[model samples]
Target: MAEISAVSEGPRTEGDDYRGIMRFAHLVRADLPEPALAVLDGSQAILVSTLYPDAPATLQELIAGGSAALDAVRAAIADGAAVVHELTDFTFASAVLAPPAVLAVGLNYAAHSSELGLKTDAAPTVFTLWPNSLTGHGQTTSWPRSLSESVDYEAELGVLIGTAAKDVSEEDALDHVWGYTVVNDITARDIQFAEAQWSRCKSFDGFTPTGPVVVTADEIADPQDLHIWTNVDGHMVQDASTNQMVRSVRTLIAHLSQSLTLLPGTLISTGSPGGAGYSRDPQIFLRDRSTVTVGIDGIGELTTHCRILG
Candidate 1:
């Protein structure tokens, strides 16, 4: 992904006046030509690049900078250095603009496995989601009717890695986390059943709608304690807690790290819980013009608008 610098060009000031909670997202406004890294303070957004000319232009760069860079950013915010804008004025881009990889876990919830009539593997059922599937909150995700009619939604907790982790212990796993976000792992049930590999079936363009925002790890007390749910249009379809996961986030990370180095900015979408539309008594696939919002408490809600082309 291309790095985005804040469009504001003026005399810089030391950010000492602003003092509040700090969240982050990539934002695009009508006035700006590209999405820029923004530090969110409640309903307001502070342009990160404007705080310092050398500030990291993307979340990946910021994660690569490690704790020192994060400290500098917090310090800059405390110093009140950047131009602040109301968040309402800008549209959100994907919370993770350019992760090194987007890894997904499947059947991590026994209830989900049972509902779908699929068995939970001895290990996590891992898969990759192609980048093209990634869309931002409030964006539209379209697919063709020719593809399949049984599209479903999976509301999941997304973990963002802060440090390179390889062969890490479960106790030290959370230490590598940068933060957390909500992910809607949209899927095409027919295609998924037809194919042995899952990447393509789940990786259709705009299949993954990521964030309205990403909260730093320090903000969340326990990843497994959070409430996760899905609201399709107005109905609460999938309601569950992260505590129900067959495997904890830390265990998943530890297992993944043993085989390969999970680099900074990697997003691991811990699997969704039970109550998927595919398993509904009468079924509840995502129809054309449907709007699905998936949320995890402490993180943020992510919404995706769908369109089915004939």
Candidate 2:
């Protein structure tokens, strides 16, 4: 089993009340054909499928099921009907599996934009990360050494939508959010600069590592106030706040919904902050056996091991 950790949970509200924030993850073991969605209880997990026969099997299903499904799961927990599983018994799957899409915003932070010599366009610098790149915490991510020796690490905040929004107002934007998770938007710097677009360079297999757990949106007081940072091989590199984003989360959602509907289970990786390894005096890129951890305070942390295959 890979190392997994869960944040401390708070008091559960009364029956059928889904107001209380809950942490969720997708757990996998050899016996289970598919990943099982579980509610994190400290370091242990209670499989949501075991909570009720109709409960969702994956995080995507749960998001699509809406509030009624969440209420039922909470009701089951409050009833003490949960069957707990040890965290050590299974490794993690991506917090989000088969999301409708993985939308990524680039250069949302002025510092990051400045550091990379890119300008934050009047509209957000948005792109897509292929689903093939999505992996989970404590997983090993590898790429051919020939691809690039300049791969970089970016720590970002990831938001999951619970409802569809075609053209929502900024004020109503946050309501569509289901939860938040940490994302390490691993990038191949050389390919990224050489390419006309960002998709291919960053979409290599196992490049995007998301979640040990997803902390419900309600638990996060102000997305802008949280602390987000990165540590590469045990050394602090990137450190900043969501406050620095050129556009807020609600702004991004509202802006995105204008052109196309932001569907349920869609993950919006809200871009990274200032300290990219690329901008450091002596650029620090991920190497074989390197461990990189990206975290959002009170939200969650994700760790990815790196390998440069010949």
Candidate 3:
């Protein structure tokens, strides 16, 4: 299993600073198109566009060069030598395929808890989602009717750790994040009520749909101030603020790090807000052909098409 980790080779010397490094390294000869981080079948590749056609660079091959690989991709964009291809032209796999573990939270919102007839726990309710549950953007996710007719959606903000974090303070937690993305924490409400554990119901195949894109940490000034919402079949279902979170991102990280070693590339899907389909006035479960989109004000919107199987 390949994971994205920091290459600890020491910082680049003066001669390798941003501007000087560009001169020292090879640059893309012409402007072809924008580049994307994509996976072809199972291997990671750089999705680049050329006048002739589209191309991909194995992520393993790119990372082999360390920082130089990122510089190459940047140079390719700066040179305008690549052609832009519609991303829809390709299929996708989970963004981070072998992430150490997928940590999820529950009952973080008061309303969601009340609606489900569950009380808020004094401590944060945390659990794990198996790696096999991940699906990609624009993909159709199906659930077994016998397993759950109460499958519901939870709009959440997903955080990707960039460094090994242990016993970090709240002030320092954000510093360890690589980037942020949107995740739909689709839940099987029936299983949630029947089982004491959450991992199974939530870890069914294709239970977690993440991404459209990951916005680098630098792009977000305040992670806790974003607006998070959800739409079911073109109707808005959830509308709330990240500020309403029972536990802020920094605090959650600091708290989690105190007990476990958070490795680089670890994905933490923060708990979702209220207005879930399972607890609606009429009770709205994701039906076959239902389209659900969970969005964070600045991060991005993630849409998933649902399917129910007999």
Candidate 4:
């Protein structure tokens, strides 16, 4: 089994209650006859099949039991009948990993806003992350150190929507969530501070490292009550609570759904809490050989090794 950790809970699904959600800390690669949706729990990679191999991998698979697939897998897991495998030899890919769009929020935390010297918008500051940037776990994310030695990391709670939402009420917004994942919103801080646009700085190839795994929505009772943190090398650099978020996850979704259709399989990187490297007294950028990991109390910790080329 790869390392596993627990975090706080988000709201439970109506009529269906569960214990805390469990996410995989290791990478999962499937070797099957057809396209498959599988989750690695402990030492097993449980297969989740939708309509058929050719059927598209939709958010519904996981969200609507497609996302909830883990639930069934866990039943077998409890019975000691899981299909456990040695991941040491398997290649890995991003979890839920491929989504319709990756949306990120900016300055949702007061501390982050102050550190970046930016004013919070009366409405939420939202941006998109390109798909080309998605990378698997334990991968080296590098850039020209010259691109901006000010590279930083933002530990954020990533929400994977389960259903299509449009003009949703905050109370009902979370119902559309399939599960949650952690996101290292790795950033080029200098570019972030300099550009009016946010996508480019945050969307550099390999900047977003998501998943070790995705925990179902039913498992989390309250998304607002988790502890999020980051460590560089061995030092704790960023630490804060999800409760500090200016707008709760529900609120952010409600707001976004108002202007755009919040499609199923959308990955929303909620803003990070304070303690970004660029805002430190002496400043702490991700240096060569730097190993940075970001985690939420119940979700999982996402680690990325950094390499800066001159």
Whole-model Cα lDDT of every candidate shown, in order: 0.87, 0.88, 0.70, 0.75
Give the clashing pairs for model 1: 15-79, 15-80, 15-81, 16-79, 16-80
Best by lDDT: 2
RMSD of 4: 6.0
Model 4 per-residue lDDT tens digits across residues 111-149: 999988989989999989999788755678889967888
Report the C-alpha lDDT of model 3 over 224-257, residue by residue, as the tens digit. Answer: 8999999999899999998888889998899899
Worst lDDT 10-window in candidate 4: 4-13
Candidate 1 lDDT, 142-213, residue by residue in tens: 998998899999999999999999999999999999999899999999999998999998999989888777
Which structure is stronger by lDDT: 3 or 4? Answer: 4
In terms of lDDT, model 4 sits at 0.75
lDDT of 2 by residue, 68-108 (tens): 98888877888755555655558988888999999999999
CA shift of 109, model 4, Å: 0.5
**Of candidates 4 and 1, the better by TM-score:** 1
Q: Better model by lDDT, 2 or 4?
A: 2
Error of 1 at 297 (Å): 0.8
RMSD of each: 3.8, 3.1, 9.3, 6.0
What is residue 242's positional error in candidate 2, in angstroms? Answer: 0.5
**What order do you get sorting by TM-score, best first?**
2, 1, 4, 3
Pairs that collide in candidate 2 are none
Query: What's the TM-score of every candidate structure?
Result: 0.93, 0.94, 0.78, 0.83
